[model samples]
Target chain A: EAGVTQFPSHSVIEKGQTVTLRCDPISGHDNLYWYRRVMGKEIKFLLHFVKESKQDESGMPNNRFLAERTGGTYSTLKVQPAELEDSGVYFCASSPYRTGPTGETQYFGPGTRLLVL
Target chain B: AQTVTQSQPEMSVQEAETVTLSCTYDTSESDYYLFWYKQPPSRQMILVIRQEAYKQQNATENRFSVNFQKAAKSFSLKISDSQLGDAAMYFCAYRSASGGSEKLVFGKGTKLTVNP
Candidate 1:
């Protein structure tokens, strides 16, 4: 089985521009999550999705940031009017929807490095 | 509102030696999980090892193992016979086992360098 995969491994844009990062979780996985890591900071969770519905989004930074999972397959994180502080590595992870011990293990993708100048 | 802390910003160890990375977490939950993730130059986060709070025995995976002190709220990773490939940024993370909170809280990470 393939691990989580992300698109546009690196992105460079100017401040105030809009950028969207995409993630395709492993086949048959219903749990998807997004996290970000700023330079010199720890990785923080942004949101989570179970199927097409959001499970949790308390970690979202602000109103400018939005995440969606359509058809319960892929996820996209959009940052409108991106600011300089939004530049960082965005990571997407996924796991099977189960209550067993193995269900807690999340497989991460090669993060997309976003640079907003 | 749990937080993970990795005190060491960087560490170095000679090849074939052993090195331990320190981590401390603050959480009131009795049941939780701890994890160590490795991110190399490729920038891919890989799970190295994990420990479930309910398990009294420490977790071991080949050359990687964890020293989990539940009382002290500490989780440390020990790499035995360190190889050059082990060089990377090691992150300590915490996750609540209940309340349907699946998000992981990560530390700032510790960069490890293995000298040949």
Candidate 2:
């Protein structure tokens, strides 16, 4: 019954460095999503995973960002050569499989705060 | 494209009092969902309440409730018996059923301060 959890609650790295943020979805959850809130900006969706397959990644900002979910249990978002603008709080959410037309409520994790110096 | 608007950037309410946070959204589709999420200083996004467009009755969760107006494309949250714990950044969100991808469009949040 645990909620989604994230790793490295806070991270600091120099510009052009690499940082990896991890997330562990709740047990039995089939859908996982990644979102972020940059400086003074609203939270925005990054990508989604259904099981081991990436259901959608249209929200991904650019090529420098990479996300992966192995074994459908956990997820990782990696930023290479991070930019100053990449500094923000990254959130991970998970939900059970949707069986009906009703929208499923997603439970969020404590976000990972990344600072690109 | 769908967008959510929260006109009030900040609001405050006395403890045990009631406060309403307004939100307006624009969308072409009729079937959609609206949500109110609270992010306290801890920065965890918590679901407050949600409203389905096809349902006429509003959604209520304990002290949290929503006033959903389909015609106005407006969804406002009313928190009754506001407590110090209620002080947080509340975001109004919109999700479309026809978008194929389950993505939430969020508005710039409104910070709520509950006075004890």
lDDT tens digits, residues B1-116, model 2?
A: 88999999999999999999999999989998899999999868899898889999999999999999999999999999999999999999988876487878889899999998
TM-score of chain A of each: 0.96, 0.96
Complex DockQ per candidate: 0.64, 0.64
Stretches of model 2 off by over 4 angstroms after superposition: none
- Over A1-117, each residue of candidate 2 has an lDDT whose tens digit, in order, gives 788899999999999999999999999999999999997788899998999899889989999999999899999999998999999999999988785545778889989999999
Give the distance in Å from residue A63's predicted Cα in candidate 2 to where it truly belongs.
0.4
- Lowest lDDT sum, 10 consecutive residues, model 1 chain B, at B93-102
Task: Please identify model 1 stretches exceeding 4 Å from their true place.
Answer: A100-103
Q: Output the number of the lDDT-best candidate.
A: 1
Docking class of 1: medium
- As a whole number from 0 to 100, the lDDT of residue B115 in candidate 1 is 100
DockQ of 1: 0.64
Which pairs of residues have clashing backbones in candidate 1?
A: none
